[model samples]
Target: MKCSAPLALASATRGRPREFDPDQALAAALQVFWRRGYESASMAELTEAMGITKPSLYACFGNKEALFKKALDLYERDKLKYIGTALEAKTAHEVAERLLNCALATHCGASDPQGCLGVISMVGCTAEAESIRADVVARRASSEAAVVRRFEQAKADGDLPESVCPTKLASCLMTVLQGLSVKAQGGAKREDLQGAIDTFLTMWPRR
Candidate 1:
């Protein structure tokens, strides 16, 4: 839960110039919402956190909800970009491994110790988190579908045993990855998450 300090709030006033720094304000707002859910985050707290006045906060990001959404979007764009690249892997196995491994690696702080913004920061925010959750759900579905497609190809190519079920295997793998995300957020180590993945991979159909 070690968070960076909030940045300053800057918004263009009267179209003259950005009176304050928008990035810092948005980042400060992000910390506010990240620590406290959108419903729980207060205007007083956000203004204090952003080092700005009430009207200025509203002027920059509209309302609290818009500000929260903007912060969430920034998080998704910056931290969740790993997912986009992983989806382009040659096989579903590769895709799933790359997706979860990269996530766990970064999330566990092998690179940075902040756990994960996607899974960790949004834990209790079902209402305000719908869009972000939908993003995760959609990504999981698309990734699993890709896995299923690759499994089908593998079966056709005689890489998997005839008993393999693409749909079932994909579902199982997705479940494993979901578990990994939660575990990583809960302070699981890279080796621990990798072990879980290895166990799941062993469940794959063998020729």
Candidate 2:
């Protein structure tokens, strides 16, 4: 099994060297940050969750801020894969639909922690966490820019009405998506969130 391979590797290298799976450790760190947010996720919690010594964490992942950044990267790469796929959709409406559905599935998944890591970090950041907040905001801006570009292309292709402003439309969609994350974090039910998405989709302009 996959679990056995890691155990075997540890056994084989026992006397020779100390080793740990970086990916597994990072995944664990991601869980901690996702659940507790960057400011609230203490070094002790991260090290304990990651199953690594504090020295090992520092050696491998740097300080808390650095580790949180790495965890954010993993979150986007693994959990937000749908964003790229949504851009490939034939219509702007289809793109929005896919994004919303994927986000709903991700936010409400039974096995994973509730809400978005990015949203949680953004909301929970304190004055001391300005750098982390800026980083999250910058990353969000990049993603929003991508969506705006997609909407521009859709408008050019007649998949979206010329009357629609791509930037504003992108902003509006992003607002709803972020709102979903906030609501989910606050214990909003899946059905209620789905209803909100349904209402928003109904109001979305057609080509």
Highest-scoring model, lDDT: 2
- Residue-wise lDDT of candidate 1 within 1-207, one digit each (tens)? 111233242332444664567787888887766556566678999999999998877766777666776787776677667777876676556766777777666566434233454445446558665765666456557767877877788668776678869788768766776677677656666788779877766665557
Count of clashes in candidate 2: 0
Compute the lDDT of residue 202 as modeled in candidate 1. 62
Compose the digit string of candidate 2's lDDT tens values, residues 83-140.
9999999999999999998999998996633788899999899768899999999999
- Estimate the overall C-alpha local distance difference test score of candidate 1: 0.67
Q: Name the runs in model 2 displaced over 4 angstroms.
A: 1-16
Clashing pairs in 2: none
